[model samples]
Target: MSNVTRYLCAAAYLDSGFRDKVLAELLFDQFRAIPPSYGGFDLMPVIYHCRRSRMMLVVRDALITGFFVIGCFMAPLSTFGWLWTLVPFALLTVDGIRRGPLIVRALIWFWACYSVFSLIFLAIMTALIPAAAYLFASGLPFSGLYGSGSTGSVLQQFLIPVVTLGIALVYRIAIYLTLVGSLKPGAPEPIIATTHPRLARRLDYIRRAQWGNVTMYANEDAFMGAGRIQRNWSIAVELDRVRESHKPSRRADPVDIDPVELHAFVRGRLIEMRDRVLRPNEGIQRLDIGDHVVTRGIFTVADGQRDRAAGAHPMIDRNGLPRFQATAEEIAAIARHPQGGVRYYQRVTINNAGQEIRDLDGNLVAPAEDQEALTSAFIYLAVEGRMLYTQFVVTVLPPAHDHYHVVDSLPTMTSGRVTWEALKVLKLQLLRDVLAAPVRVVRTAVESVRQSAMTPNPRDHIVYPYGARLSVRELGASESLQTHIQVLDVGKYIKMIEQRLTEAVLDFLEERKVETGAYRMQAAGITVSAGNGGTVNVPMAFGEHASATVNGLRPGT
Candidate 1:
């Protein structure tokens, strides 16, 4: 089977209609290159002309209509021929009215109104002239309204229609000129004079690695809505283009890029991101450290001294005899021992400072402090092909910022069940701690005393004690306190994090060696700041490494 047919069959699995169309086009060469035409005339040029002159569509309609009127009088064919001529004019007029610019449409409407008024005025004048002539003077030059072959009479007869048509023609010319000035196509894309195969190859590798798909926003609605800014990240792919007028998907020729320069760009961007996009405390909030342990293992290099000491030595026996009888398996086992013969390494907690944190009570706090303490964290990186992937596990713990107000409602309870409804009533009574405290306290006390057999004076009851303390055992059972914590603005932190990462990526691309063409490149990423559930995509580009360079050419050369 041909490549086109195979492609069609593969697509058939997804869509039958598309497959059929492709197959048909392949089978019939005529379908592959079908020209657009109507009634033996090519319509493509006409279509292009219309598109190119969209603003002056009104002129086309007016001209067509004027020609139709003239043709209807001049045609020698049947009445039907004259009517048929009106069809295209009618369609053009409707299109021009609907699609033309405001100014053009306005001019068309003015011409139409003037034409109608002229026709009406001509009819009125023709009738009034004869009546006036008969009443005033019977044998004047215009005695019968417009007499016998005189220039004055001829001018009087056709003045309105001629003047109206003249004005319409003048307006059409003005519309044409306006369209030419406004709708010219933009300049063509510039050709790259030089090629950097290494740079191009590296770029392709980065694209395949999906470095651009970084998460940057945690809550877009809250972030964008609060700021009153709306943005689209997909268009970011077009940002690297030097020319703003080009379409978003247009590709430019590859340009030369230097390895040393690209490295500097990447390094600079990493630093910028560290300082600006990622907050001083944002990543700290995401640290993986727990109470006194680093949940994620700490990674460090092994010491050369330890590696040497851990290596296995040849076996020696007494009397200077070498034990050479050991089996190959035993020797191999000794050499690859899980820990004995392995390189030396150590594990330690991931902390910036050795100082311990303390609470207000002077008690030792957890290794992972509150949001404020999480201002910095470690960045883990992995290299695959030409791409670098960064990952970090962040730990966030909500702080206690709420006040507790315990209320004793034991006095309100009697020998009845403590249902949810009864609890709600007692809650309201406790909440009324400010106004009319004494009155409500007294009333409730008396009511309670009457219901029960206890002989306690109602006047002695106290709801809120200022300088004295009064204990009521009945109300003591309803003690409760409300605690609230301050809400952390995670949106702001996410925004900052995204900005820092983007800046880092840009800095990576902006160095001298890389020779970035990203005059307006916009970096975008998802803000995966929500627990282990967050996701983000970030597009990135960095120049070839110096080690990959050969002879005189750069790494990507």
Candidate 2:
């Protein structure tokens, strides 16, 4: 398995709920759109792994059931008939008892241990009491009850199986511990590919299909997981003609500049920042203009076609994938409109080295020296109601959690070591594989059935707001900046992007013959406040909720 796949699998193994969510939302929810993952991580391999694990559970269940049936039949003919019957029941009882509330499970385990101790105590006293009586008295007191064919004989018969079962249980536990110890990340890649090449190919196909699509759901903040908001401020300056004192009549004339043209100019300037970078690896990795549209939910084919005909087309392509771009006219219209549902943004993505890069097939494309981190700045420009509006929201996408990176440091095992470890675990694992099979079978079946039943044509039902709201990359990302360098980089990129954005807006205003006094003052204040680590709050004309403020410190600090 690739590093990315290993991290994903380790994540799944560590967190069952996250694993189930990935399967349910991404793999099983056929109708829901799968969101595009940013920060150079592929989510498809994780989906494939979860699916494969589920299948393995089914196979394990089948083997266990087969063994159980054979044991039941052999119980009548074998000398260890009682053992066969007791083993399965013992496994089931133990498995069932382990689950439920934590406190209850603990109490149950305590009671079981206490009961076993009591039985051992009684057995020792029965033998010792009879021996003492024989030594003290001529005829053994209670000899009939304690003799070989009576209590003593019964105790021996009972204790023999109990002791044997205890030893077997200990051996089984050792096997389990060995199996767990042998479980290093990336160990399952070869087995998965060797066992299921066709499934692996299918996953690749799915990954390619969904790679670029921006899966959106209601109320999903597209900016979420891009990292903490490092800077959020907007400037709206009135579009007033520069007063020519000698030719005052020109002031009455409206400023003649199209919002589309202005937006294009700003976008070009931002894109040019990439070309100006002196260091390729240290500079922006991605720079482009993208339209981010928030809608009620995904459109059905009929709804999509109708919207297309009506000229208010949905922001999805024919294949039902998000088209993160709109026509110039559409952008101008949305910008001019007072409501805030859609906007065009110039996104700058700066990827720091020391992060694993993987291909669509989960193959390693780039190796890492250290943890990977991404810093992105989104700049939105709009001209509305004879005022120029410019906004910047900078975010940091931190590296994946350290636990996920454990795969990179896994010990290298020689073929002999691998074989020996497997052999050591094989016997006990086989027993457990059969004994715990029923529980696995039932759990897997219930989950499979639940997912299948829940799958529905979203259009057929009344539209509910709730839908799959998950991003695997975001889910896997570390909660905060991993290192001091990441913090420094985030601040550096934010400043660079902000500087470019400020220059672009100023140049646009100057070319349009708009007065720049107010804009320059606001920009100066923002820059100074941000530099001094003071909060900079901008009054948003749109509404109170639209207003944003930035704390003085660098993001992820």
Candidate 3:
């Protein structure tokens, strides 16, 4: 047996009362932790890379198109007649190429049709003009048709320019139609949340795993230190209950069900999950499967034993036995049975190597299995509110697999869970240095050094690039002074995660064939609305019902 197995077995044999606890602590202490990572650090880097790659492609096409257009314009700008007519064709091709593939194909078809029709039109004009001139010169024309022989030649010359203009107009119309059609959104590549394929695949696996009854808790005091008097913000989420509420009913459509409740439910879970995953014991465990490494978190009992006292539902395996160890009697009975506890434990296994041991009555005794677990579902929560927005900006190298939950952005293993808090943290960290650099430099010059000529004026403009060069006059001298008082931009992250989470939840519902309808899905956080009189956006029931006047005026009125 492996060293880990031997150690676990030895520990289990020491004392049954503290056996599981001791083993878990040993595993947790020895195993590494994987700090969470996203998009090879965070999403911004990946986005920047994608944008750079796509822009490079566009630049390549633009250069080629520009050269083609210039070549076509050469003749038109100089000779300025029949051959100059090809300028529109060149312009259309260039426009198509710049707009991307869909428009390019449209422009190609337009060119093909224009080529055929323009040739036919020119051919007919060529024959008709000359024939008409010949008839007029032969003196068979009436007075109005041709006053003199030279008149026919002048009229024939006018037809060529007119034909060129008509063809150009037709080509323009075709190109315009194609451009309009291509203006709509194209089939975009799927939003890749991460570049790690193994992580992504594990997310899918967890999504399919039994998570209905899986409950997750928060790591209380993760933000605020412990032993401080705080409001009862502790919140808990029973995913099974939340999911069961959405089950199909003969009386109602799933869409009609106020999605606000669903969003609220999920938002709480997401917040708790984030807090859990960021902490020491509540995070994920690294599991090595074949050649790939993935994260897996057990959301019930951290140990193999089920928490029956917590009302955890029993899990039944494929072998028609309880998935977890429930009672000692049941295990003893299974041991004495013919199957011999083959499917009794999910995490434990004892290899007897064909050596049979007999009990006091000469009954065959099954070998005991000692399970080595490095993951836990025991969470620490102490908040009743959903996470609206938190702005934490810290950038550090991702830790090893034994140090933290490395593969997952969110700590929970359940599919479709939100990582809004983590996302906000990443985004804040990415922009932190860039946003604070100027302030820091100015502060250091003015406050820290006390000798520099650097003076920040509120009226001064801060230049930032947007498309081309654009300047915003929003910089202030005392901006750095108020940096500590800055409010978190939680609404943006909340809205973003809410949208993604809503889609995911709806997709899951659709697969279950639930009837859906358009419903208001609001983010459960501090909501700010336009034109409010200090309106707090929590549940309306949390209103300030008690009022008192300390002075002549009502306090908190």
Number of the top-ranking candidate, with lDDT as the measure: 2
Residue 445, candidate 3: Cα error in Å is 36
Write model 1 residue lDDT over 123-172, tens digit each, in one string. Answer: 45654555566646755444554344333543544443343344434443
For candidate 3, the lDDT comes to 0.29
RMSD, candidate 2, Å:
9.5
C-alpha lDDT (0 to 100) for residue 384 of candidate 3: 19
Clashes of 1: 38
Residue 338: error of model 1 in Å? 22
TM-score, each model? 0.19, 0.65, 0.18
Alpha-carbon lDDT, every model:
0.29, 0.56, 0.29
Task: Looking at model 3, report the run of 10 residues with the lowest lDDT sum.
Answer: 468-477
Candidate 2: stretches off by over 4 Å? 1-6, 61-109, 115-215, 241-254, 277-313, 316-341, 354-370, 411-440, 462-468, 527-557
Candidate 1 stretches with Cα past 4 Å from truth are 1-307, 312-378, 381-383, 397-490, 512-557
- Please estimate how well model 2 matches the true structure, expressed as its whole-model Cα lDDT: 0.56
Q: Residues 146-178, candidate 2: write the lDDT tens digits.
A: 456456534553544344344434444432332
The TM-score between candidate 2 and the true structure equals: 0.65
